[model samples]
Target: MNSNNEGKMDVLNNIDDQFKELLELIEKEKVSSFSMKHFDRLKKKRKTSKKKWFIIGFLILTLISMYFILLNEQLTYNIYFVFLSFVRLILIKKCVNTTEIIKQSNITFFNFTKSIYLNHLPVIIDDATDSWPAMKELTLKKLFQLFIEDPVLAENDLCYFETNIRNYNQAEGADRLFNDYINGKRRSFIGQWNNCKRETLKVIRSYYNKPYFLPPSVTQTLMGNWFLVSAGFHKGTDYLHRIPLNYDWVWLAQIQGSSLIELRPKHPCETICSILKSVTLNKGDLSNDCFFLAKESYWTR
Candidate 1:
């Protein structure tokens, strides 16, 4: 019986030794796996660092090449200047052709639609406001009188008064009293009136209609439900400066004034300012207004 007990104890000891060996093997495997993972991470980081350095080196090389080329007077004169001049010539030719096409096509409703919606171009339609009675009745004198009678129309904080050719962004703007602005000819302009309001002047609202030349689809899509009006005594000086808008389309009607308009293509490389088209708009003429439209995706400032 004692021998039997001793044999059982020996068997148990052997099993215990085997279990400890297995545990040690598993621990070694875990260590090996952890080391492999750490090595792989280090390798990946090295590769990423190399890629970054390569990109930086490539950029530095390119910039150095450009600097050297620019420094070489003969190369700059022959290559850079020649290429720029050629590009400028092409742009000028395109501008001329575009202007000629606009003049030949005339400013009909069909042409206006095609130009804005289809061609994605700017167009000027003469005498667009001739039919409106406000053109004859809504003179500067009448506008001043209306403001005087109804001060509420000019009481809005958004109303802007410009005293010089410099835009409000470049210089400080003031909210001049409507009565004072009209009474004094300080060569200023008053604008930023929301004519769509119910309390808006009746005279101003009388002529507020959708541009007859605009297609129904365009007006509906762009929400052409409101008209914004600006009145000023900018006879000799340029009053309206470049004002960028996020709207898909803009229809500017010179209800009772004449001004010179300079249009720049959205693509800066497409045309030079010297060769760009300049349009002179005169009130009472059939082409007193212009429409500028751009596709939502293609629109620039």
Candidate 2:
């Protein structure tokens, strides 16, 4: 009995010692893991801090280089004068007479060919868009629906937007515009969406008839569709502005809201022909129902 008891005591002592060693091993392993994790975090933070400093240093160097270059060339003086000239032009306000744009109502296609086109003057045809179904059928909601169906059209991501009416530099996507306009998420001004596919143009053309004023000799070298969506006022601010001159003739069909259209001749024509014409176009019956036919010779808004 004594021999058996001694053997059992030895076995119990060995098990307890093994368990203690196992716990010590586990504690050492946990401490090692914690140290490794702490070291990794410190390394990442240092890398991020280094990257930020590098970017700041690069930008400072670029600006200093640009300043020295500008100083050497005396280009800064030229830039200042150009800016001063623009400011001077804006400050000078003259109460000059603005001529009313020429309007021809109920005119036959022959008269349009002779008077407007031959003379190369911008005119408002009050009855030109009378037969266009788009004047009746097209709405803001319908315009969004037209392009939203095709998965391919949604990929048209490079859309021009006017953040401020005076500046047309912002760019966004048509899909974003559709979403913003429909969901009432954001207020935006949409500009030209050019280079439309033939299938897309065909769909849009079905809503509107071609102008009868277009001469039979006129050939369409390029077909384009521009969707201009705006609330007339952006963020409750108003500024006088003009559309940049497009070197081609443009027929603007105002399907919905009223816009004040102003036409002025090119800079060179300012001396000889100082004619500035302004007109208001509203969509309705024959009298107010009008659209603008802008010639290449004028800058219009």
Candidate 3:
């Protein structure tokens, strides 16, 4: 009976030793897995650092090459001009294609709005103002006669009178002689008149009828509270101002005279100090008058 008890105790001790060995093996495997994860993370970090260094090195090399190429006196200016010319040609081609599409497609006001909204591109519609009574009656002579007859319209507070026809520099407190200015220098003036004012509304109603191509639905969405009448005497005069950045769209109708318009793309990363494209509009050419619809993301001159 004593020998049987001793054999049972020995079996129990062997089973305890085997369980401790299995626990130690599990601990070693946990440590190995942790180390492998740490090594993988380090390897990934090293690869990212190498990629950044390679990009930096490539940029430096490119700058050095450009510097050497520009150092040559004869090729420097010529190369710069050549590159500019190439860019200009590409822009001109784009303008020509756009113009051709408009001419060929017979784009109406509805389609024009759709195209601009969907593509966010600028468009020029010719002969848009042919039906306007202002096109036929609002010559420089007739405008002066109308203003002379009505002092209120001529000297309204909202009217902007400029001595320099070329720019917006106002003639500091200069006497506004309507007849003299119109007859003499024929300088341009912009009058703020809309349908809200009874007196001006009468005048606007006579000549500035709603465009036939514009649907009533589109008219409802337009910012119609303010309407400006811009009259200029000189040929090259322009009103240059940046459109408010918040505005998504703008339309300019040329009432009279010829104009040269230049436009450039606005980019967040770059300053646009140059014009990308320039187009000249002449009287009764292309269209009797033109309407330019532009996305506010474009800078116009």
Best by lDDT: 2
Model 2 segments beyond 4 Å from truth? 1-98, 150-152, 155-162, 165-172, 187-192, 195-199, 219-221, 232-245, 267-270, 275-277, 284-301
Ranking by lDDT: 2, 1, 3
Cα lDDT tens digits, model 2, 1-301, are: 9999999999999999999999999999999999999999999999999999999999999999877746543244345434533543443222123244567677766786455443444566667777877777767766666568655455454333343433334444555666666688654553444534655555566666556655433433224555544553433223324444343345666677655545554442344334543456565212111112221111012
Task: Give each model a TM-score.
Answer: 0.45, 0.51, 0.44
Tens-place lDDT digits, model 1, residues 60-146:
999999788766644543463245335443544333344421322235567654443344334555555556665666665455556
Model 1, residue pairs in steric clash: 125-287, 126-286, 126-287, 126-288, 127-285, 127-286, 127-287, 127-288
Best prediction by TM-score: 2
lDDT value for candidate 2?
0.52
lDDT of each: 0.47, 0.52, 0.46
Model 3 segments more than 4 A misplaced: 1-106, 165-177, 185-202, 220-247, 265-276, 284-301
lDDT of candidate 1 at residue 150, scale 0 to 100: 56
Better structure of 1 and 2 per lDDT: 2
* Worst ten in a row by lDDT for model 2: 290-299
What is model 2's C-alpha RMSD? 25.4
